[model samples]
Target: MPEHSRQALSDYAVAHTTKPDSIFDDIARDAQTTPSAGMMSGRTVGYFLNTLVAITGAQRVLEIGTFVGYSALMMATALPEDGELITLDVSEEFTSIARKHWARHPDGHKIKLILGPATETLDTLEPQFDVVFIDADKDNYPEYYEKSLNLLSPKGIIVVDNVFQGGRVLQQDVPDDQRSASTRAVQRLNEIVQNDERVNNVMITERDGLLLIRRRDAHLA
Candidate 1:
């Protein structure tokens, strides 16, 4: 199938599930016009992030990727008045756009943008995130996943995006040129999650794919 067709299907699915908020729509517009636009996650993924934050009653959240900040806005809007979300992104330009959209909301103050490599940002954080969203560099996904789990509080959930790589994970004989470095890296992370004993996990085929992991508290071999 063509790439546009796949995106259409994904958009259709998301439309039926959740209404697009104004902040999300504005971010979509910014992404369309921006040079590095493709980094943004799909609306389906944003909806899932919103739902997960609300359902988990998460007050403190950590996001590994801000992109144009669609997902950050969605999750931040779900938080209570006292809730806060700290987001980390490496791109100064993209995050500048994110800050603009966030400023429009009354709860915008709840959103904090950390400009730096996510690994470095995660390292400095104190453990106790109610929810964690990982959607940054694919090559560092496993590292992000491990660190996110450690940062999560008891009963916290960690959501990892882009695990399916547009259904490429199941395909064999794909040309080396067509497969992305990130795709290969995500495939390895998928295996790690499947075998990990520290979390109860499930892979949902959303816009791309989402790995939902709830940290395990007990010691395991």
Candidate 2:
């Protein structure tokens, strides 16, 4: 499929699905004017995250990236009134924008922002998250996955973003560079999940790629 065609289909899908409210629209508009606009999860993926939280009745959610808090806001809305979402990011600048938007929503209070290196922050979290969404640095995906799995509840799910690494994962030869290193890390993480007997996993191609993993025992039960 051509890039334009794929994007058209994506746009059509978002148009037909349940639309996000004005608060979300406002955040998206603000994100578009920023240098890191592409980092936003957009409508399609945001809805998917919301649906996952709803289906799981996830009371405690852990988000690894929290870029502009778009995904966190969507998930936070899906949570029960007493639910909580802990989001970790390294940038104060990006999260400051997120905090502004979060303050507009009633459920915004459910979102907890922690600014620091995620690798260090991951260790400080309690092992109680019902859903874990990892969308942080690609090079640290393996470490994030390992820590996230330990933090998850027995019946929890882990959603990994950017698995396709901007289509580099499918290429036969990649130049040796920092980007290639990130691509290799994503590929290695996919392989690790594929071979792990403890979990059942599936990869879906959307904006980027999403790898959804669930504990094998929970999946079978």
TM-score of each: 0.89, 0.95
For candidate 2, write residues 41-116 as lDDT tens digits: 9888999999999999999999999878899999999999999999999988888889999998999999999999
Question: TM-score of the candidate numbered 2?
Answer: 0.95
What residue pairs are clashing in model 1?
Answer: none
lDDT of predicted model 2:
0.92
lDDT by residue for model 1 (1-221), tens:
78899878877887687677676787889998888677788677777888989998999999998988888988988999999899999989888888998888777899999999888889999889989999998989989998998898888899998888878887557776677888878987999989998778898877778889986772331
Q: What's every prediction's RMSD, in angstroms?
A: 3.0, 1.6
- Say what the RMSD of model 2 is: 1.6
